[model samples]
Target chain A: MEKIEVIFYIEALSNEKKLLERAIEATVESLKGEKSIEVKDISVGDILEDEEEELLKYSGVIEARIVGSFRDVALAALRYSPAVVEVLRPGKMEISARELMEILGDVAVFMANLMEKFGGLAIYPKLDDLPEPKIGYSRDEIEAMIVEDRQILYRFVAEVYDKDEETARVNMAKALSYEGCRINKLTVQKAPNDDKKLLLAAEVLSDFETLFQLMAKYVPVALSIIEPEVIDVTAGELQNALTDISGFAQELITRPLKKQLMDRANTTFRLNP
Target chain B: MREALYWEPLEGGKVRCKLCPLNCIISEGKRGSCRVRKNIGGKLYTLNYGKVSAIGADPVEKKPLFHFWPGSCALSISSVGCNMHCRHCQNWEISQADESFPYLHDMTPEMVVAIAKRYGCESIAYTYNEPVIWYEFVLDTAKLARKEGIYNLLITNGYINEEPFRELAPYIDAMNIDIKAFSDEFYMKIARVPSAEPSRRTAVIAKKDFGIHVELTYLIIPTLNDSEEEIRAFARWVVEELGDDTPVHFSRFFPHYQLTHLPPTPLETIEMAYRVAREEGLKFVYIGNVPGHPGENTYCPRCGKPLIVRWGFKITEYNITDDGRCKYCGEMIPIAGKHAKKRYGAEWW
Candidate 1:
């Protein structure tokens, strides 16, 4: 009978209590389900409660010893456990816990083995109180959302007649009525090479027709300085909406969307350098 | 979240949602594609139920019901979620937003009725967002509003299945359905739907089966579905399927949402489309979004007179008599509404 030992570190968010419990249970369950490995007692110990401990410390410990056929056995079995499985929460909020078996499989016992060789030994089953999100979308529901349309800030360049910020503001208002749009942020910058030129950046939300109608009235050049980036559209235009719309089009780049593009093209070729 | 209207249990703690044509078989803890319907613990739940995203008072004419209670106002309400991802969606924000978005206002069906009565709104319109997706909310509100003698109107994309829509029929009084485009290709690619036939069927059922007042609006996006053939076909279909007096609104499509790169529907194209619709044996074809245009007025087809004068949402004159007959020719206008005569009697006009 061959015996194998594996260890790894896992850190959860500053919160999430139930998460720690399920992670530990799932880890233990995986080893229990392995048919080839004759189970020995699974030891989950070591409360990392040193009075002065702060960051980079252990929270708990999980150790299991079992006679197995493969070099690394029980951990590989846990990967297929249906109940204590790791699942993504679909969209932006999906965060996964670091399963000890999966992590130890990839990262290996480097730190623990190194520390053990030097006479220091400590380990914690790192997890916190983050809640697990259960997402159960059927085939039809997923397809509907996938086929749904998304919106992003549509940026278009228009030659402007005014350079001053006040006139630029007026030009925007004159072009698109404030009835539909709300300007959330505005930044002012000077043209890199030419101090005589000024750039006006304002984040405004309106319909595509109204936004372009107003923007086209003002020129997009720095000297002409009429820029209204789409900060957010009114709620009327958000049904079946995509949360992130920045990828919809690449033609007109807004300030926050890609501020790096605002730099002067010839700045890299400055004669002074 | 409210329990959804139509869904069945699937294997492995999943549920198959039968709300719209997108029969989403949702796994446990996952949501259907609408973002409002979630599969929680093997049960389908509608998240947008009673969660009002946008609500306000709009003139019934704004609903463009043209025939249904023409001059009255409706307390329009909507929650988030739509069946299609139309590139030119005008009200995409609330319609496309998830149920958790901060702006959603919580209200019950009873409360909606109270608001309409308080505001003197003759009807309550489930609008702005696609009303079909908010079925539970609309069903509750529509039933309550009907009992209160307040009309219930659904301004929707009309992308709904027969059973759910028919279930809503008894309570819904009128609906302003957006036809989008007459072609299946437009519905498949631009509107992101399997086909346009189902949507057309919803309109038919709304009027014929349920006897609900129905009006259709076709957004004329330039260089897309604004061809004369589509407009003529749509007009012909209305006459054949619904009727000649169906009141088809040829609304000018401005570059909106994803279709912003294109220009606002050209006036020439709208004029041509309007002419084509009228020539195709359709009565009551109206042009919208281009304010103060002569097409905004409702003219008597028999008398050849401007029967109802309007200046963009404002009714300047109504020449229909107390009996729903045209003043000049005494021709029945096929109009169904609470006329001024109902309030002021014979001496009003």
Candidate 2:
């Protein structure tokens, strides 16, 4: 077996140029820290504005030369979803049966996560009906909405409260539940085939910062906010995003992922994962 | 959300919960050791306030306060969370539950009182889980229940601090405190608490200081806190501290929760504990979790005759007078309140 050298071209786009640059930096740092993946050189391009999208939208790309086993490179490519993978060494690559099996498992896990997020998105049957301009919501108002909304569903992922696992699940659900916000679904199970940590999933409403504040009493895990307009596959443009060639596999992956991955693991992954 | 009864703000947006002996100093957006009390923005709140995880009309003997309105029915209610994490907890499904446990139904103090009255219960038992963790709701409900002519009983671990216990004691008419074992080591190891001394203190205070009818339950688990020495010590303590009149129930422990590897308490262990308690001068000793056993009946301390013969939680025959004197020997039994009118018919097997 020969160590493979490759150039991974990664790109990220965000309204905030700093966030975009930082994400690329973090991705490179993550790759460097990955086992069996050696970083040789790095070329980080300057942040460029996208005139077509908006005045604020910015994008950045980074090209890195890395040497690693085929398995490690494949995992990195799956995880990071780089724009391009240009092989710098090995005219022919050979992967053992075990390695191929492991790669398939990793791919299954990746698809499972992606499908879980889509399944989560599918829960909000009336996402299209959400009166959204995607504007700033005051913390107090959002809290009030979370406490008052009976129809809209939100998702929260938290670590199992080690001191008391059952209570952790209860507390997380209770923290998010209010007068109108009922915990429609809640589960506490081992963290995605990893027994060391417990994962809790709850369906309720919360703002990002307030969700962290509320969940902090139960578990010390980070939470991500899913904006209605982030990709409204429920509506016209978002639905198109799913129907397009790039999103076709994701559309097909939802049902099986929910049954196979979510049901088997008994843990829901973060939408951002 | 209900503001907790016994807590004070601390530095760095933290709060110290003084409700129980644990005295958990919780940071902002974190719960105390009980998992029911949370510190939010330097203020402590009882998260499970009015969160009823379990509620039922149970026989008063089931709370196992045999001497307190012996044959009456108590509307027992419990919220999730407990201060002490007893490894052999029977009701771990609810006791170890968090405030936000999905099955918990929202209840108010008034609603609980109404339900108890509707059920014709003479008393309301804050039970199943450690009621001390549900201090805010229990206190509020107990006070309301007391005013409604409904007796308030605490089926507790007695792991509470003096001040909070004192505050709630006035409303409590009777309590069956679970003294897990005699030694602090057993308390630390099994319940994961620093000491069982606090429970002892609470028991004493409930009996001597507040005049609350206090009974003790010592669960006998095989190979764990079931030693003759510990049981004898516990019996001696009850005799000395809680007085010879205290009705001590030596309940049998079955494999449960974290202690599934351990075997159920043998009949001999329960019998031996009963014998030891009697030898230690603790009168009114009863064996629990053993249905239809001879030791389940109340025996007269002076006459050595069965005073109240009970089959399971049902009293088959009662020999005690309305004034609470043993019918056989005329010895005054330390029974609290009058014997409640028997509610069970012959069909209640």
Candidate 3:
């Protein structure tokens, strides 16, 4: 393997000046502890206090010549989130197929785990906690059907515009008997000085068109289909979905590394000039 | 409200609407499947009778009835509501709307005929939405239009039942029916209808039985229906059932309404459909939604010469004799009515 030198520009923020300075010193010392890396130089800037945030932030750059394989350098970037990484020497490096796959697999697993954690936070009030409906199928039953049979369910709250409330009830009764449909609730309300209208909330176990057909039976003057507020996905499906997404994520993760190490081997930037 | 035809009153004020194959059993004060026909006091009433939701003076070719009165202007009108709930409806604003749409304009049959004359349109086109759902209004207007020597054209999905279609067939002079696709699976999945057999059956009856000038349109969606085998089957059906001269249009599908996730139909797919249809031995084949392709023009079936050159909906060149014979090879084109002179680029306003 070719030896490559890289410069990592990193930043650390803390409420106290001592802690901010200590964090940067410890990061450089940790990088030198690795046997495959040689610490060439460490430059630390003065800690500055921000009045807006009420915190002291210190910035530093570490110049290290790494003599390890490609996996070691990539693992370093994943371990420390640097503001920017610049490769200084041995512009281009090549690795075997196994190393490339290992690097991508590590990033994919990390991303999948992070997404799962955040997804768990976003999904709250488990399906069991939802109040049971008085009229139709329970949420748990519907959720189970969605996962098991892969049946898509749609909820439509149709407003039937009519002068008679009895007619709306009769129509709702007929619609409830339609195949693959369940009436959750039906309410008849009249706006002030306006004609009576029926607000019928129903769930249809079919595609968008079947749901529409179920609603059209009422002859609604106008209707709107409401989107489901919460959806729960099984861990198996989430893993499969993330596996498909990882292929695209691999390109996003590797483009910058390839550009810095291979594409711009002879290119140099003068920041002060 | 005008009393709707083709409905039978069941026991207890309920009525079964026989207007279309859907045959929705409607309760009193409720509407049938179309959303415009309501059952009131033991009678089915057509709520959209003479209710015009949209109106335009469009070129007949825009309805894509290329063989029927080639360059004539048609007074196109629509009343809201549709029979089938197609996921990719191009005119969902009107087709998916109810009779309570705020922009509805009330125009009687006489007024529609008068407007057609006022606009110098030779034909009145019941279009934009499915005219089959607006059964009562279209029947009344077409009857009046026929009496006034004006052609009645129905641009529809042809989802109507046989009895209603037969009663209204005499008044209709020409029809451009959208076939959607050939497979029943595509129909069930995308259009949410049980089958597309009704559309094919209607086209055959309109052409063979009634002798009404008929044309077919198939909007080709990417993976939903566009396949060489499917297009060939459609073309073969058209040739066998509606005859070889029934002009078939392969229209390009754009992502619209609920199908916004899909990409627009590629030009290559449209061209492939055109080739496939022609390979099935259909004489008159055209491509729609594409402006200047060679497939947009009408060719002499016998001599293979471009008889009429069109750019979009405008006829740029006409090469037919006074008697409807091709000027190039004297081949008798299966034209329905006399060709109207070019309305655009003329000195007369």
Candidate 4:
């Protein structure tokens, strides 16, 4: 099977650095659990350097090579462009050019859709049209609106967790809420999904930073439980393994844990059904 | 807005509000920490007086007050604003808002009492948010309700000052005060207040001084305030200061607001806290939030028999005598009701 290489260049202007960072991180994590696209996160450059000549012995199609500015990171004033997310790194044959394009669309949707979510410009193939602007708000005002949009999630949390915030931080943070309204069907801007999947993904959600941090810590802790006599763990292997284990762990730990919280939160708060 | 008490004018146009422990010093035209009281023209005024954000007939059990008229309903009412900004505030929609916060109706003291009576509620509860912040409104309503033979229950965070609380005490028959955490840092950092002293002080004043039926609620957040030592110490404090008869509820925590990153407290943690409380000499202990967890049901400490069987707010069985005693052992359960509501659903009382 031949592998394809696709590069992306995403440009956007967001006042919030955290939002932009999450846009990138979620785009990467969002690719998880896709049946068709086998997204193996490996450095194609490193793989090429190691096994470039070996591939010359075999007659195989190049499949495809697509490149553009993949995504951009703006830190205060600094910016980085062109992050290449490889779906094919000299792998076995089965994937076609059409499948590669679809996979490319998936990756592009991640960067494009996420950047668009922050009210920023998303540069992707076949998606440059803009929607009419509703209102211009400062970051704080926009934050307040987001909190307003998810009042129940936030109020329920405040009721359950009992957080005490004294000064400006809490007062300011209180302006943001995790609680959101349940809409069975809603329009999602750049979610990576087909018709049915995108519709399913359109649900109430918020705050991935803490979740990302937890995941960041969860892998090492989970892997540490393995007690490998010989320590030879790579970042990619660890992440891939974590992804595999997370699916099983989700059923065993995460969902039940959440249901426990949600059931109690709903019942005790007598939340509206 | 109505004239507010427990405030004094300072050197500047700002006035200091003495209602709760936050003791917010407000500039003219500025509200205090609770976002309910404002200092207008060197005098304080409460904007939320008689402005009810949430008013509903809720089971006293939903308030997690098992001993307080078990299976009866309380007409729960709350106006916006609270002095402390607990990040995990259950009612932040109302509690963390300014008095000008919309979504509230104009219900006078007469209307509040009348509504409770209309619903056949066992009591009128000043609850949902911290009740102490709406001092004047609760004061006026409770006084009127007392005249009408309606019990006034104040569900609070135990952060009120001595004088104002005691003055309101005679009118307030029973209260479920939330003791958020034993750590002062938890009170200061998590609840965004100066100290836990006000909470401790309020519990003492409510139970010992005023002779009000005071129940305690502690929400156990995972890795935050779920330590057995801290919980046991809190239980010990309840037994020593409040009394052995005090009903303590170790409620479970769910992810919400800014604390969504936190997972739900492990069931084992809640169970362990219950055991610690029972070990401490507290007579009535409860585990809340998790419905069908046996702990939600009331039990007689003497006979160890389930008195009022509950699943969430619904009462499934009543094993208590009509006079608030265990039907099995004939031991008094120290509850406020003449008889537990035998039928299903709320509003039976």
CA RMSD for every model?
A: 25.2, 19.3, 20.1, 19.7
lDDT of 3 by residue, A40-128 (tens): 66676766666644222333444444444444554455455454555554443443333433544554355444433332111111122
| Per-prediction share of native contacts kept | 0.00, 0.00, 0.00, 0.00
Clashes of each: 43, 2, 0, 27
lDDT of each: 0.63, 0.71, 0.70, 0.60
Q: Which ranges of candidate 2 are over 4 A from the true structure? A: A1-273, B346-349
Residue range A50-139, candidate 2, lDDT tens digits: 675533379888888888775566566656666666776665444343443344355445544664455321111112211211223455
TM-scores across all candidates?
A: 0.58, 0.62, 0.58, 0.57
Question: What TM-score does the A-chain of candidate 2 achieve?
Answer: 0.43
TM-score of 3: 0.58
What is the lDDT for B92 in model 2? 90
TM-score sort, best first: 2, 1, 3, 4
What lDDT score is found at residue B225 in candidate 2? 90
In terms of TM-score, how similar is model 2 to the real structure? 0.62
lDDT of 3 at B135: 88
Query: What lDDT is reached at residue A9 by model 2?
Result: 76
Q: TM-scores of the first chain across all predictions?
A: 0.23, 0.43, 0.39, 0.18
At residue B132, what lDDT does model 3 achieve? 94
lDDT of 4 by residue, B97-145 (tens): 8654546688899999999988788799999988898899999999999
Model 4 ranges with Cα > 4 A deviation? A1-273, B340-349
Pairs that collide, model 2: A232-A238, A233-A238
DockQ of each: 0.02, 0.03, 0.01, 0.01
